[model samples]
Each structure stands twice: as C-alpha cells, then as structure tokens.
Target: MARQPALSASLQPTLGAHRRLMAGLIPEAGFHAAPLDGVTFMRADANTTPAPVLQEPSIVLLGQGLKRSYLDGEVLAYAPGEILVVALPMQFDCDTVVQPGQPMLALSVRIDMAVVAELACQMDPLPPLPPGAPSAHARGLSVAPMDAALADALTRLLEVLGDAEASRVLGPQLLRELHYRVLQGPAGTGLRALAASQGRLGRVFRSIEQMRADPARELSVAALARDAGMSVSAFHEAFKRVTGHAPLQYLKLTRLHLARSWMLDHDLGAAEAAYRVGYGSASQFSREFKRLFGLPPSAARSQPVVPA
Candidate 1:
C-alpha cells in the first residue's frame, strides 16, 4: 500500500508526456501517417461506432482510452499501458472509447517480417512448446503489459516525429529497439515461432503471404500443403492452429478485403471489383461484402477509404 503512490508518481510523467505529444500531433479524429514508413498515429475524440477493419500484422501501443476488437466470437480489449501485438492479418470489428475529456490515442507500427527474422537469429533458442499451450492460431493476437523500456522507446520515437531529418536518422533504430523489446516481452515466444523459417507457424506464415499476394489465383489446399512440407490433414490442423481460421474461410476473407480495397482505392465498380478479386457472381460478392462491412459495395463509396 505504501508503494502505490510512488509507483503512480513514477508513471505520471511518461503518461502525461505521451498524452501531450499525441494531442499536439493529431488535431482531428482519424489516422495520420507518420513521416516514416510503416508507422501511423491514430486519434479518436469520442466513442466510435463499431467498424470492420482489416488490420495488418503490427504492433499497436495505446497511450490513452480503450479499444475492443471482436473476432471469431472473441472479445479482446486493450486498455492504456498495454501493447497489442498482432502476428497475422486480421479482419475484425473494432471500436474505441475514451473518458469525456480525453481521446483515443495510439501508435500502429507495421511489423517487418525480415527484421523479426533477423532479430530472432540473434536471440537464444526458444524452448519446446509447453503441454496444453494455446496453438499459434489462437495466439495470433496478444495483449501484454508494456515495460518501461518499451514505453520510453515509443515516447522517444514520437518525440522526433516533427523533425523529418531526425526521424529519418533515428526512427529506424528506435523502431528496431522497440521490436527487440517486444521480442523480449510476454509475446516473444509466439513472435519467435512466427519468425522461425522451418517451424510450423513459420511455414503457415509463408502460406498466408502467398494467399494475400494473389487472392484471385486458384489456390488448392493440396498445393499449399505440399509447399509447407506437410500432409493435407496435418497442414489443415497446423494452419488452423496458427491462424484461427480454416483455409477456405481465410481465403474468402482475404478476397473480400481485396475487393473492397479495389472499389475504394481504384474506384472500380462493384462488378469489376468482384471479378478482379475472383468472385464469379456479382450477387454473391455483394452479399458477402454487405455481411462483412455492414453495407453493400455501392454504399461503401461514401465511407472514408484507406489503403489496405
């Protein structure tokens, strides 16, 4: 009980600094691209209506407010002071809420798989999987307490955002350090597993990349299994374990996301977007699009569109 005040005092400055920096950097409620590649700052001034978002594999640090992600009937919420690490592309409904006077503030840094692999090589070998440990599929998204080192690194990273030269010179190093710190934190095991080239999860990650690259291609489960060096049944089990979705289901979601991107970014018509993403029927595409996004493709034109 005696230590509580001291702890709170210690945390006050860091939290206050983060809040100030974010408030100054973001003047409105939307995603703001940072000068650096693969980094974006987000702010929301009030509770948001739930919206379907296709989030890439990334590390998200929340400095204020609360976020809830609904996926596969699971509700994952991350409060301020926690780090959310997503190890795979995820399509989910997300909403944010904040105290009356505060805004939702966060940093979203896309994960560089190559960097993860390089760092994993220098770290100590990971231990064997523990008995009854959750499979990699369900482990794709993790929320863990942020340590001081990571918090400090993130704060420093944002401090340099206003200076382009400093951001160019120092941003990469700080981002690397942030990744290293996360690799050493609670989500490290799952991250390391994903980075291992010969590991089961690693192979699954490779397969995911292929699917994303050409969602329109005729991809067969047998071929994907062969590429992963696993039998069909084994591949199915492993893929589900690592990604939380069956192969066909994952493919469907990927295609639908790509189709939406086409309609928004390229201004493709619904039929054209459907055909481009390998949908054979316009009605089928519209149905799925409405099901996932809560609106038909035609209605999506009015909504704000961001690059996928």
Candidate 2:
C-alpha cells in the first residue's frame, strides 16, 4: 500500500507532545473526565464493535490509533493529528478498533456555545463563504487538519490536566484559546455562521429547538418556515445548507433519538418509549429505530450508552 500522508511539519512537534501527555494521563481503558470541566480523556485497549451513540456538539482530537463515525449514511474517519468538530447534537454510530498493544486514545471537549460566540467576536472577520460552500447545517460535523497553533494549544490544555491549581487558574484561558484557534482555521466560517443569531443558520437552529421541545407535536414545513420568518423554499434551502437534512427528516431522527434516550435512561419499554417521544405507533417506531440503528428496540436497549 502507498504510505499515508503525514501530518504537516509545523504540527508534528505538538502532536508528539499530545501523544505523550495523553498516554501518561490516561493509561487504562474507558472514558476519564479531566480536571477541567467539559474535558474528557478516552482510551480503549482493544477493538470495539460498531455501536450506536448520541454525540453532542464537541471537539474530538485523536492522539493515537483510529476511529470512524457514521452519520446519515456518511462515514467519517479520523486519525492522529486531526480534529473533528461537531457543531450540533446528533445521534450516530461509531466504531473504534485498536491493535493488540496500541490503544485508541482521544480527547473530547464539549462545546459551550456562549464561549464559541464570544471567541468568534474577538477573532478577525472571516472571509465570505463561496456559493455552495459547506455550512454548519451540512450535517454540523467537520474534520480539519490540526494546524500547529491548535496542536500547541491542545497540548497546553492537556498538560494542565494533572495540576489542580493550574487547571483552575489557566484552564479557562487555554480553552478559549483553543476555540479561538478553531475559529481562525478553515472550519471557522461554518462555526461563525452557527453563532450568528440573526443569520439563516441561527433561524434553522431555532426551528430545531422548537422540534426538540416537542418532537411529537404536529409540525409542518410551512409552520416551521413561518416561525423562522422564511418562505418555504428559502427555509428548505437554508435548513439543508446547515443540517444536511430536510426539516421533516430532522424531526424524525430527533424523535428516534429522544425515544432511544428514554429507553436507555429510564428503562422504558419500546411501546412506552415510543409514545413518550411522540410516536403513536409502536410498530412504526420499531421499524424506524432498527433502520437507523441497525437493531430492534429490544437489542438497542441492551447496548450500553457511550459517552459523547
């Protein structure tokens, strides 16, 4: 096989430091929360079967091994020295496979929209995105090369994980720096679009919030468009631009995710979970759940909920 492309030279040094820090910080299996709030370290010593999961908006950095995530039929693979930015909450499937001795090591930082908005304001203005450019709604997930500045900032953040005082005093600043670095990178435009409250992306996000508030409510494309103050045609285009899914499709997935949460968190049976999340028919819920998750409700209930 041809040799895989290497990380940029500017990024290599910090990537090495990140690997060492994570290896020392998380020496065993399972997800470990760091001293800093919203920061978590994960390690898996052996390969894992593909599993269904709920992922919130966050930044994921891989320091060792590899992993893959599937969302709406799109498969995204991440290796070392790359960063995965999820700009919204979505349910998806993930698989992480490790060699006999090498573990899959990763760092996850949950996004704080407030912080993201604040950081975006302080950064230099982003260039206008070209027509047909990928936006925050184009699935809300993006993978970008980890540049030297981001790598260094991440390394610094991880280094402070072992010191309580340092984490307390410097953690917030370092976290802000990391977010700033991301806003300055290639993916910055999408993130900025997501944070701009008066922008089209923001309107769609509000519509999403309405659906999340009541997933089972009788909703229509026209109603959602009216609420967003857009014509149906404009709403459809903008919504698809940001989320990569039509409004109705987004609602269906949201409902399924809600039902899954009920089953996993409250131990609700399939029928009860379905009704709780606004499904009127258990059979219909079961069919859709299996179609998206590759398992019937009964089987999905037995699987452990992976931390996002």
Top of the candidates by TM-score: 1
- Alpha-carbon error at 203 in model 2, in Å? 2.9
Q: Each model's TM-score, in the order given?
A: 0.90, 0.86
lDDT of 1 at 135: 51
Candidate 1 structure quality by residue, lDDT tens digits, 221-243: 99999999999999988787666
Least lDDT summed over 10 consecutive residues: which range in candidate 2?
1-10
Q: What is candidate 2's lDDT per residue for 96-153, written digit by digit as tens? A: 8666777888999988899989888777766666897754435577777788888889
Show where candidate 1 strays beyond 4 Å: 1-9, 131-138, 304-308
| Candidate 1 lDDT (Cα, 0 to 1) | 0.79
Task: Supply the TM-score for candidate 1.
Answer: 0.90
